[model samples]
Target: MTFSAVARSADGDSFGVAVASKFLAVGAAVPAAEAGVGALATQAFANLAYRPEGLSLMRSGIEAAATVNRLVTADAEAQTRQLGVVTASGPGATFTGEECLPWCGGVADDGYAIQGNILTGPEVVEAMQVAWLAGDPATSLARRLLAVLAAGDRAGGDRRGRQSAAVLVVRPGGGYGGTSDVEVDLRVDDDPAPVEGLERLLRLHELYFTRPDPATLLDLTGDLAAEVTERLSRLGHPGEPDAALAAWAGMENLEERLAPGRIDPVVLDLLRKA
Candidate 1:
């Protein structure tokens, strides 16, 4: 019913699954990730059991292949199960039920699981892996995953066609009330440009939800702050130097911040760091 990839980074700091399908709630079902743990994507008559069970198997010191083997063995419909996994340990594995549609295959290596089923072709997953491996290791997993999804789209993804896409990545204490199990969870449902939409959301998360990178920090002092005030003055937020500087210096605090639109302050940060 879908093609999916579950993988970890070369540095093992992130683990994620990027999946696009003609399926609904793909994010809630197909993508399972835990920071400092493991990741998995189960599809093609997917067994939701794979989410928790697979992770449990991994935590118990099972390899991706063996974990998958255990899950499928217990499943009466193993012929219709397609699974891919990457462990926090940087191990990788995949399985495409012999009953899966054409262009179904996967590559598991280097802390990554790249796979797809009922796909445009094997090239989709291959291109995704190549794009990811070529990406900057220090880049956010969301960005790297977005790159792969874009590559998949370019490669003619989802033989049944695309309607939605989702990404899930997590870390310790990353969940809401420590129960949400997400560092980043974005879904684009029923969109003509789901991956692009997801990218926009990811950028927003980076700006507001995630910490500011050192390069993203800028001195909110001096003439640069003045420039920011002058620039934002016309944006209806009151262009007074103090207000603008305050906004730039994060006067409203990070809680009131909005993404990609905080260009004025970011310019100050850029200039300050330069």
Candidate 2:
């Protein structure tokens, strides 16, 4: 009924889970993670308690396999559960219950776990794992996870069908306004094409939440500066161009991309288009 991947960033500063299922709002139930701790996905007959309990065990220095063992041992219906886990320190693990539907299984690697129940075939999970292994480690974890999910879905996702998808990534101070580690948490509760919907939301998340690279900053000066100032004035921002640009970026929740003497070219383009 679901396919999921739990992973930690190459730098070990972040961890997250991405999941999709024929089940409604799969995100609300299947995926869970904590920054600098670990991540887990519980499906088949998902045990809600396994989420917090698994994370707590990992936080207390338990290995990913041991965490799965503990959770399954405590559950009376363990044979019906499918679980995946990735520890912050790089170990990973997965489990598929004997009573799970046909084509149910998993693959675990050094830093990630991919699992699913009632999938099209082992190829669905194989495609996901291959995509994850082939992903550029330097890229954002959310994008990496989403890419693999797209691959899995294209390979004939959930034999039951697609109703929802979600991606969650966490890091220290990764959340908006520096208030949390929920770097990216998106859910398409009942979309017919939930994986595609998740990808769309992820692109928006990158725009609003990611910091611009300094190498891409555009200096405000001469004709460009004048144009920017005029645009700001037209937008009802009456002030020095630099100050107005700063104010505008702040209003758009893009202040982190601001530099004292220049603005991110993308931010300028976004402002121009607005």
Candidate 3:
């Protein structure tokens, strides 16, 4: 009913999980991660406790394989669950219980784990592993995870069909305003194409919450300033262009991209489109 990948960034500073399934709101059940600790997905009669408990074990310096072993061993219904785990260092681990439905299995290697149960076939998890391995290390962990999930979807995901999808990524100072570890947490529950929906949400997340790249900052001056002022005036924000732009950005939830005496290309493009 589900397929997932859990991974640590190439630099080992980030960790994430991406999953999609025939289950409703699978995000709420399958994925979990903590910055500087580890990530895991528990499905097929998921034991929710495995989330926090697994993170704790990883934080205490337990390796990924050991953490999976400990969790399954302690559970009386171990044969009914599937799990994948990756920590800040070393190889990851994947587990598929003998009692899980047909087409259930997993694969793991350095820094990543891919797993699924009741999937279309072994190809689903295999495609995910290929995508994860081939993804550009320079890309954000969230995007890489999404690519893996999308690959699983393209390869034929849950045998029952798709209903939900989600991506979770974490890193130190990666959250909104650097206030938390959650770098990206987007979900598409009950969607006909949940992976596609999740991709759109991830774009919005990057635009709104991520700070502008310094190299792309455009100085607010001359014709650009005049055009901005005119645009703001037309939008009923008549004032100094910078001040009006600031006010508008706050309202639009784009304050994260604001910089003194400059505008992000994304903000300017949005203004023009508006």
Report, for every candidate in turn, its global Cα lDDT versus the true structure. 0.74, 0.91, 0.94
Total residue pair clashes for candidate 3: 0
**Leading candidate by lDDT:** 3
Number of clashing pairs, model 1? 3
TM-score of 2: 0.96
The candidate with the higher lDDT, 1 or 3, is: 3
lDDT of 2 by residue, 31-60 (tens): 999987899999999998999999999999
Clashing pairs in 2: none
Candidate 3 Cα outliers beyond 4 Å, as residue runs: none
lDDT of 3 by residue, 146-182 (tens): 9999999999999999899999999999998899999
TM-score top scorer: 3
| Clashing pairs counted in every model | 3, 0, 0
Ranking by lDDT: 3, 2, 1
| Model 1 alpha-carbon drift over 4 Å, by segment | 173-181, 224-274
Ranking by TM-score: 3, 2, 1
- Which 10 consecutive residues of model 1 have the lowest summed lDDT? 255-264
